[model samples]
Target: MLCTDCLALRDQVAIYENELDMLHEEHQTQQLTDIQQLKGVKNPRRSGTGQLGSLRADRHVFISDSGAKGTIESLVEPSDGVATVTVEFPTPDVTPTILGIKEYYCQLEESLQFEFKATSAVSLGDHKVAELAKGPKVAVTDASKVTDVGELKNLIAELQRELADLEKCGEELEVEIEERKEVYLEEIAELQVRRPCGDSQSPPAIGWTCVCSCVTLCCVEELENAQADLDTQMKEQCADYDELLSEKMALDIEIAAYRDLVELEEDRLCYL
Candidate 1:
């Protein structure tokens, strides 16, 4: 019933629609591929440094330049395959516990103690390093030779300020930990008073037991979270400290070079 020109135009329109659908499908597929590629780039499984990937949990991972094996305690993977791995080695003073405690309260206490020790050690080490570096202040014999002596002084002053800030942060962290410990102790004592035993069918008593368990779990998790935060803080502080040390060494070298230049200038002026 349709004219030849009309039928031909209808077929052409259908072909164009099919082509568009195919193009759309291809576009969607390409978009998906791009998304996957971006994710892979963000969280690379294999190290760009040519480190081999392993699926075995017990396999030793090398973390240092010397290729020393460290037992991977845990791996936190916030993004797909990429992880922040915590590697630990067996030491005489501190050994990782292979077996976990069944009791919730005991586990919480143990976690708290472990975090406390780690935080203490890092703080103490930082303090000692800071003290050692502070001594024998950079004495510029010919301060006039260094044109940017004021800048160098400012840099050193900034380092001192950073150290003070770090000390303050550590004190704050300790105070927070102490406060948390007190709160935990109070909760534990309250739980002890309300400790339910013997098969009680009462709904209220059962609910109370659940609450105690939840509280215990929350305490344990909170301590773990605090430990993680402390670890992050320690890394940041260490980086800052290293930067300060590097700057100090560079400044010392620059000062020495300038002093030599000044001496050369003096000799030339005397000759003239």
Candidate 2:
């Protein structure tokens, strides 16, 4: 987070971190340690930020006079309610296709694009960012200044590192999700076609199918193999995401300490 991807988290990192702290503090004794010890992602003993609960995707951090709580909530509210999936093209000129899930869990009444810019406004893609960039590079960022010239420079540098990381993670996750979706879809088709005919055979159980283990597998063996792969992938993602959460927790403490340090230094400078 310190090196890469914090920039994408720009506005909402504080709210998520703060709420996590709130939940942790609420638990009092060994709850925090319990969370730390859990090797699996599905632990119900811990609080739900609901996949994200409080954590917003793609944060970009800055020092602002406005408190972190309100600032984060304002920034993420629009984007949080909607889950958007977009397919990217290798060609830079072409825009990616925005996709809808086969099963949507929510009912939303809102805009065409689910994402937003840092301003808490309805901002669009790279074109708008490019146009904004045509002005002074620091123009937008300068508005949120809560630090001296040196600190602002450091913040900008940190944000840039985060942006690169965010892009990398986003691309990786997209590729994986799409690949799994395609594999499952193909298996479904094959299984339906190859399904046993007549009253001689009984249909397979819902969870255990020839086409998809979680869905329908072309072969029962194939289902087991696919599920094994999925299990491995899930374990890997859980580990990675757990690492991220750990980092976030550590960062939450560090940032608070940094704030204290900055304030103390400010006071010492004033004394001089």
C-alpha TM-score for every candidate: 0.36, 0.25
What's the distance in Å from true for residue 219, model 2? Answer: 20
* Residue pairs in collision within model 1: none
Please write out the lDDT profile of model 1 over residues 148-177, one tens digit for every residue. Answer: 647657655665665566566656656766
Report model 1's TM-score to 2 decimal places: 0.36
Best-matching candidate per lDDT: 1
Task: List residue ranges in candidate 1 displaced over 4 A.
Answer: 1-149, 195-203
Tens digits of per-residue lDDT, candidate 2, 29-88, equal 343344333322332223454453342222233333432111111112233455232111
**Each prediction's whole-model lDDT (CA):** 0.48, 0.37
Give the Å shift of residue 179 in candidate 1. Answer: 3.8
Name the lDDT value of residue 137 in candidate 2: 22
